[model samples]
Target: MSNANSDPLIVSHDLESISDVMRIVNREIWVVTAAAGNERGGLVATWVSAASIDDQTPTVLVGLAPNHYTTQLVEQSGSLTLHLLRESQLDVAWNFALGSGHDRDKLATLEYLLGATDAPRLRDCLAWLDCRVFARLVTGERHLYWVDVVAAARVHPGDALREHQLFASATPEQRQQLIANRDADITLQRPAAITWRKCLPEHLYFQPTQPTN
Candidate 1:
C-alpha cells in the first residue's frame, strides 16, 4: 500500500496535519446576508462565534473572505443578518454557496424582510441574529467583524445544519463544484495571507516596537 504522506493531493503535509486537528471542532453552517442601499447579497459562512457573554450586551464575531460580494455589502452597510439553517434548508445553502452575487442576485428568490439593522433576514431559517458592525479588522484574505446583536429571534424548531451533513447530502456534481471552489479560494487567498499588512483605525492602531541590539 502507498504511504499517506506520498499522496499527490497533499500540497503541504504540515498544513494537512493542522487540518486534521481542526476537523475535531464543530463548525455549524450559517447564511450571512447584507444589504447596502439598493444592493443586497448573501453567502454561506462557517466562521461565526459568540464574542461576548455579558447578559446585557451580546456580540458575535464573523469572518468573511475579502473577495465575496457579501463582504462588500457588509462593509458598505455596517450591518448584517446571520441565519442558522435547519437540516431541511440545504437548498438555501446551495443557492448561496454555488453562485457568486457579482454575477446575479442571490436573494431574489428567498423570502426575507428587512431587520432592525436594515439587513435582509431570511424568513425560513431556524434562528436569526440582526447585528450592527461596531469594529472591523482587516486580515488580508479575510475581514473580521465584531458585531453587536441589535435584534434576534428563534423562528423554527429544528436541528441547525452542520458542515458535514451538508457535504454528505450534496450531489456528485455539486461536490465537484464545491471542491473546485474551495481550491480556487485557497489559490486566491494564499498570496494575500503571505503578504498581509496591518490596516487599522487611528484609535485602534499602535506602533510596533523595533528590536535593538
Candidate 2:
C-alpha cells in the first residue's frame, strides 16, 4: 500500500513544513493599480484569484498589505485594476514592486490610461482587469478585497510571468534583500492609515535599521 509520507512533495510532518512549499508554488504575478480622489498608486501583487465561477457575475479577490499606499487608495476608492505582465516585462514588475507611493507617484514614470473606475491600466502588459470592491476581509496582515470584474481586456499577447519564475531567477543579492525587506515589513505594525515610509525603489528591498549611538 502507498503512503502519503512517501509522496515526493511531502516534507516533514511539522506544522511549519509548508513555509518552504509556498516559495515554489506557482502563482501568477500581477500589478494592482488604484486611485482615490487625486491619489493614485500601484504595486506588484501575487495574491490574486477568481472568487466566483458565475458567468453572469464574475468576481475576483486580491490581497493587499494595509501599509501600502496603493492599498489605502483602493480602500478609499473601492476600486482596483489588476495587470498581467509578460515574460519580457521584468523591468515593469520590479519598477512597481520595488517602490512606495507615499513620497511620489509610482506611476509617474510609466505609461497608462485611466480606466472606467479611474484606476490606471498599465500600457505595457499582457492584460488588465478593472474591478470594483464590494467587500473586504481582514486576513492576517493583509486585506482581501472581493470585487466585481467591471472591465477587462488583453492589451498584449505573450506568456505571463509567474511567481516561482521570479524567485528562481532572482540574483543572489536581490533575493537576500527581498528576504530582509519582507522580514522588516512583518515586524512593522503600521497604523491602519498613515504614511510612515518614503517612496523609493530601494525601500522595497531593504529596510535599514538605525543604531543607537
Candidate 3:
C-alpha cells in the first residue's frame, strides 16, 4: 500500500524560524488590506507567506491568529487584496494598526474601492493584487492563508513614495559632515586625547615651579 508520509518530498529546514526571511520579504512594500464579508475589514499587515498553491496562480500568504476577527472574515470571504501604500502614507499605516472596527465600522479607515471578487483595494496605493484564498496552514494558534493572486496591475507610481518612507536621499556632503561631527564628539569624550586634545607647546609655555617645602 502507498503512503503519503513515505514519499521523499518532505524537505528539512536548517533555520530555526522564518522571521529574518519575512522581514526582508516584507520590506518589498507595505500595504493596507480590507476584505469584505458578513463583517468587511481592514488590517495593516507586514507579514505574508505562501501556504499552498492554486493551479497556475501564485498563492500569496498572510498569517493571523485563528481567534482574531481578521481570520473569521477571511475564512468566510475567501478573497483579499494587497495595496501598496504610498511613501507619505504613514498616517494610514498608524491608523489601521491602532484603530479597529470592533466597536464601529473600520471600512471608513481609508480610501478604498472594490476590486476583483469584491476585495477592497486602497485608492492611494501604487498597485494592488486581488486574490482568492486557496488553503490554510495551522501553526499553533495562527492560520497561514494561502491565496492565488488572480489579478494584478499598477494603480499609481508608489515606488518613489516607498523610498521616501524608508530611505531618504542623503547628500554626500551631509553624510561626510555627520561622520566628521560624530568622530569629533567621540574624540572629545576619549579622555580628551583620542577624541580631541589641546596643549601649549614647550617653547610657548614654561614648566610649573615646584613648591619649596
Candidate 4:
C-alpha cells in the first residue's frame, strides 16, 4: 500500500501544515536578547516570518503562540528587537533554536548589549533593529507582532538582503575549496593507491626483460 502523502498524482497540492510551514519559515534566523527590561532574560527566536518590504517602517513581523513566554514579555514591554544573522552566526542561530533559555542564564554566556530601547541586541549580529510594537494582533493560535522601526544599526554594510540566506548552499568558492580539500586529504601519509593499466594479451607486448642467473 502506498502512503497518500507521497502520491504526486493527487491533483490537489497538499501544502505543509502550520507546523510544517514553520519548519521552513523558521530556519537559521537570529535574534539575540539580554534583559527584556525587568524581565531579566532574552528570548532568542528563529521561527519568525518577516515580510512587507514596502511599509514605511519596512516591517518584519513574527508570530508567537499566545501562551509562549516571549509573547507576554513582548506585550508587556510593548517593543521588541530583531537582528539580521551574520555569516559568522551559524552557531548562535543553532544554540537558541535547539534549547530554551527560560530559567537559565542564556545571556551571561553570550556577548550582547541593550539597544536604544533597552531591548537585547546581539553584538555580533550584522544588523539590528529596536522596534516598537504598534499592535499585538491575534492570529488564530498565535499573537502577531506589528512593530514600528524606531532605531536601526548596521554592523556590516553593502550586504545583500534581497533573498533569504540558508546554510544548505554555501558560496560556490567555499564549496569548491571544501571539495578540493577533501579530495586531497593528507591525513594518511602513505602514498595513494596505484592505478593499474588494463591487461592485454602477453603476445601483444614487445618489451624484453633480461633475467640474471
The TM-score of predicted model 1 comes to 0.85
lDDT of 1 by residue, 1-213 (tens): 434754333446578688888887768999999999999999999999999889699999999999999999999999999999998998899999897899999999989999999999998899999999999987666899999999999998879999988888899999999999888888898666655533344665578989999
Error of 4 at 26 (Å): 8.9
| Whole-model alpha-carbon lDDT for candidate 4 | 0.57
lDDT per residue, candidate 4, 1-213, as tens digits? 544543332323534454366456435455635345567445445546555677575676776544445567677777777777676565565454333456555556677777777777777777888877776655333467777777888888644221135435446764575455434432221122111112324654368798999
Question: Candidate 4 has which clashing residue pairs, if any?
Answer: none
Ordered from best to worst TM-score, the candidate numbers read 1, 2, 3, 4
lDDT of each: 0.89, 0.81, 0.58, 0.57
RMSD, every candidate, angstroms: 6.2, 13.4, 24.3, 23.7
- Candidate number with greatest TM-score: 1
Give the better candidate number (2 or 4) by TM-score: 2
Segments in model 1 whose C-alpha atoms lie over 4 Å from true places: 1-13, 197-213
Error of 4 at 160 (Å): 8.3
Q: Summing lDDT over every window of 10 consecutive residues in candidate 1, give the lowest-scoring window.
A: 1-10
lDDT of 3 at 89: 64
Error of 1 at 24 (Å): 3.0
